[model samples]
Target: MTTITTRTIEYPADALTMIGHLALPADTGRRPAVLIGPEGMGLSDVERRRAEALAELGYVTLAFDLHGGRYLSDPEEMLARCLPLLADPDRMRGIGNAALDVLRAEPRADLDRIAAIGYGTGGAIALELGRDGADLRAIGTVNAVTTGRPGDAARIRCPVWAGVGSEDPIMPPAQREAFTAEMQAAGVDWRLTVYGGALHAFHHPPVDHTVPSGVGYHPQHAQRAWRDIVDLLTECLPVTK
Candidate 1:
């Protein structure tokens, strides 16, 4: 049976309050913990299921919230909520650090075997954690941006995996090329996988196509991306039986 614990973790100094859902195997012993950042829509059911799925792979997964439980399906509403946070680099750092702190505080969490994964804006936050010198074992991002603090990329000290859709208009070929170049210059062990014909937010099953610039779901790529993420975690932070 799967074991899950849901709780609200308040950020120190009013940085940004977040609700976290921790999922694990029912008989979980000490295991690696993954701090998961949700997409721009915030911590939806999809993100929660992602955490539970990771737990089935023998991980203590923590899914963090950036928007404090408020979610939007409309593009305008989502942008209105996300744009300000993106503008403030310090706020993003605080949110990431707070989530990390929450994960570290869990007794079942293997502090040395911690990793992070994020989707979209959350992906960018995960990258920022690595860039800010967090000693993560690995990092994975899906449809994420790498446009945070300047020179932060040079500080990543762990393996990084980035998954993007070739047809994603927000992150086109030029942007991907630039991101790869930045990682190369930083000397980071990195991998980039591009899924052809997939749009943004391919993993989100309930994508609203009625909206302008809406995204469609791709189950195949989503499953493959999840597999790759788990494989990366297993390679970097092996579980000892």
Candidate 2:
């Protein structure tokens, strides 16, 4: 097993102090890094575990906190916090760039070989960063498939890979069409994978609280989606030893 280390970090963002969980691989040298964004529910054990997994695969990773270290279980609370952030690209970018600065500060992180992957609202953040023209090697998102303002996708400078549940109501067919159209129009190398019979947050594991309609845990699809993300990193953002 690869040796992994984790730390809790605090930084300011959007008028609040944001917290992040950083993880590093056993190697003491520089390596590729990934920034992880969580759903509207905020960062939880699931996101932390994902960061650790990436670290084990020899990448420095950070799971960013969206709610100032608070985990929201109520859908209403989550939407309340996320909706506005979604509508405001600058605010989402503020949160993302803050965690990005923290990740970039890590001595072991390869500044030039960076990627961002997120779920739900976190996914939206990833998209915004791309639209804002961050020099990312790759961008992978799940569930949160919102497109940016018209012409904004033209700013993306890297390959993008997105996944969504086929039955997800939040990102139904029309939304997917618009997203893909923007990607294609911008001539970005983008790919989308839709898992059949799955719902929103299909990549998530079961939780104690109830989720909204068209939202449930799909373990098999979850694993598949993770593999796809890993594959994306391997292809577009491989870290050379």
Candidate 3:
């Protein structure tokens, strides 16, 4: 494993105090940065580890928080909070921008060369940032195929890569088609990958709570999705030597 530095940061967003995790490569020079958005359950060790992994790859990374640092393991609680937040694009943008500001302020991050990668609810936030006209090198999402407001996708200026499970009920074929149509109509550079036989939140690890139907982990596809996301970042926001 590559050596890296990690820390906790507190910032205000969505009318709440968000506790985020920051990870940095060992070297001191400025490098490209990545913003990681965790699943709807909120920030957890899963996201923190992803941030560390990205940092080890030589990019400064910040795993942004949702639900004010609380991890909502209960399905009911997770949906109750995430549903309304996901419905409001402005709110999503606000959360994303707050994290972006923190990342851009880091001395080790190259402000002009930053990308955003997110999962579930976090992925929607990344898309919202792109639709809000935030300058991003790339936007990578996993299982968050939610569409933005009509005509707003045109505001996205970077390449977008989305991943979904072939059997994902939450982001089924119909929803995927709608999202793709919006991207196509907007002429945005985009691509989608469907992992065969996988389900919604396929990237997530097994949990203690009883998950909803069609929500489970697919280890193989999870790694594949991560590799694809890293490739997107490397192609769009390579770390400078």
Candidate 4:
């Protein structure tokens, strides 16, 4: 059985000191690394567990933070913070690059082989990193199929995979069409998975707080989406055990 190690890391991003979770596998040898971006609500135990799970699978993983050690349950607060940040690609890149730098600095991380997977706001950050020409092996995003700046998708130097709920009003068909169109125009190796009968944030677990309409969890789809993400990494950044 693989023994995983986890820790809390602090890094500067978006002018705030973000608290991130780092997970490392038992082996001391360098391994392919993955960066996980949390949803707009911020980093929570969910993301931390995901990082640990990836580490157990033999990859160094870092679950980067969005709200500087805070988790916002208030939808209004989350939107207020995420709206502007999402609008500016440079800010998103700054956040992603900062986390990437931290992941790269880890001795166990193979610098040349790295991937970015994110959800919600974090997904947007992953896409922004790709658009900024980050050397990622693959980019996997869920529930945030945002179209990047015109002509920027061409800079993505990796396979891009996106998963979204088919009925997600936030990421409706038109938005998905735009995103796919951009990817197609850029000639990127890209794919999209639409989970039927699911709503926005289907990958996320149910929260104690009341969520906005169209946002809910689907147990089966969540598991499927996770498997898809693992498949993406396995295909693009395989780790030899």
Candidate lDDT scores, in order, read: 0.81, 0.92, 0.95, 0.96
Q: Candidate 1 has which clashing residue pairs, if any?
A: none
TM-score of each: 0.92, 0.98, 0.98, 0.99
Clashing pairs in 2: none
Error of 1 at 189 (Å): 0.6
Candidate 4 residue pairs in clash (backbone atoms < 3 Å)? none
Top candidate when judged by TM-score against the true structure: 4
Candidate 2: misplaced stretches above 4 Å?
none
Question: Per-residue lDDT for 4-59 in model 2, tens only?
Answer: 89999999988888889999998789989999999889999999999999998889
Q: Give the C-alpha miss distance for residue 146 in model 2, angstroms.
A: 1.0
lDDT of candidate 4 over 1-241, digit per residue (tens): 7588989999999999999999999989999999999989999899999999999899999999998899999999999999999999999999999999999999999999999999999999999999999999999999999998899999999999999999999999999999999999999999999999999999999889978889999999999999999999999999897
Best by lDDT: 4
Name the better of 2 and 4 by lDDT.
4
Worst 10 residues of 3 by lDDT: 205-214
lDDT of 1 by residue, 99-167 (tens): 899889888888989999999888888988898899899999999856655677888999999999888
lDDT of 3 by residue, 1-241 (tens): 5479999999999999999999999888999999999999999999999999999889999999998979998889999999999999999999999999999999998988999999999999999999999989999999998999999999999999999999999999999999999999999999999999999999998988778888999999999999999999999988767
Winner on lDDT (3 vs 4) = 4
Q: Could you tell me which 10 consecutive residues in candidate 1 have the lowest summed lDDT? A: 7-16
For model 3, the superposed segments whose C-alpha errors exceed 4 Å read: none
The model with the greater lDDT, 1 or 2, is 2
Q: What is the lDDT of residue 65 in candidate 1?
A: 85
Error of 3 at 136 (Å): 0.4
Give lDDT: candidate 2, residue 178: 90
